[model samples]
Target: MNKAQVVEAVVLAKKAKQLTWESIASTLGMSTVWVTSACLGMNSMPEQAAEKLCELLELPSEAKSVLMEYPTKAWSPAIPQDPLIYRLYEVVGVYGDTLKEVIQEKFGDGIMSAIDFSMEVEKQPDPKGDRVVITMNGKFLPYKAW
Candidate 1:
């Protein structure tokens, strides 16, 4: 099975098993975000994790190999149309320059390394409305001055 097929199988298995990403991650001893990303075919899973995930999801053995394959990391160049995703794009568009300026001032001519990054999503309850909090942690990579 290819990554897309594996992803479809995983999603179906997850729904059929009534498993949450948190539960799956806990069983695999991995972070929820990372586990979800791997299952969704964004990141390659480690051999052990892939095996364990396949076992947990009752997926075919071939899925393990597909889960471990490195992704091409490509996406559509056009702006996403989904509201949630478009909101993220809008946030970046609005804050990109401000974040760039602040980060450069603090860390010099550098960029955050998404390759070495982690993110978490949390919920904060409020009387008005529940709030979603997202935290991203990434390594700062400085530009080579040569």
Candidate 2:
């Protein structure tokens, strides 16, 4: 199976089993975000983890191989149309400059490394409405003057 097929199989199996990403991550001894990203074909799964996931999902052996393959990590340049996705894009559009300035001030001239990053999503209870909290932790790579 290819990456897209593997992703489809995984999603279908997960839904059929009524399994949450957190549960799958717990079973695999990995973070929820990382596990979900791997399953969604955004990241490559390690050999053992791929085998475990395939076994858990009752997927074909081909899926395990596909899952272990590194992804191209490409996306469309067009603006997203989905409401939730568009909102995130909007946030970056509005605050990207401010974020760059603040981060540069604190961390100097460099960028965050998505290759060595982790993220978590949490829910915060409030009287009026629930709050969504997203925490992203990425290693800061400072520019080296050569």
Candidate 3:
């Protein structure tokens, strides 16, 4: 089966089994963000992770192989259609520079490493409305100079 098919299968199994993404990630001993990304075909899992996923999801042999294969990062040029996704993109567009400047000021000539990052989605109680708190922690790597 194709990668997309595998994702569909896993999603179906998850639904059938009434499994939550958080639970799946916890069982895999990984972060929900990372595990969900891998299950959705955006990332590759190591062999053990893949095997565990296969067991948890009851994935076929083809899916196991597909899960371990490196993924091709592909996306449409058009802006995201989903409101939440578009809003996140807009936030980056508006605050990317300010964030960069502040990070540089605080940490030095460096950038946040997305490769070595962890993210969490939290719910904060608020008087008016509950706030969706997204926390991103990444390593800061300064530019190497000769």
- Candidate 2 segments exceeding 4 Å error: none
| Model 3: ten consecutive residues of lowest lDDT | 56-65
Per-candidate Cα lDDT values, in order, are 0.96, 0.95, 0.92
Model 2: per-residue Cα lDDT over 44-146, one tens digit each: 9999999999899999989989999999999999999999999999999999999999999999999989999999999999999999999999999999997
* Prediction-by-prediction clash tally: 0, 0, 0
lDDT of 3 by residue, 1-146 (tens): 88899889999999999999999999999999899999999898899999998999888877898998899878888999899999999999999999999999999998999789889988899999999999999999999899
Which candidate achieves the best lDDT against the true structure?
1
Instruction: After superposing candidate 3 on the true structure, give the runs of residues whose Cα lies further than 4 Å from its correct spot.
Output: none
Error of 3 at 94 (Å): 1.3
TM-score of candidate 3 on Cα atoms, chains taken together: 0.91
Judging by lDDT, tell me the better candidate of 1 and 2.
1
TM-score of each: 0.97, 0.97, 0.91
True lDDT of residue 73, candidate 2? 96
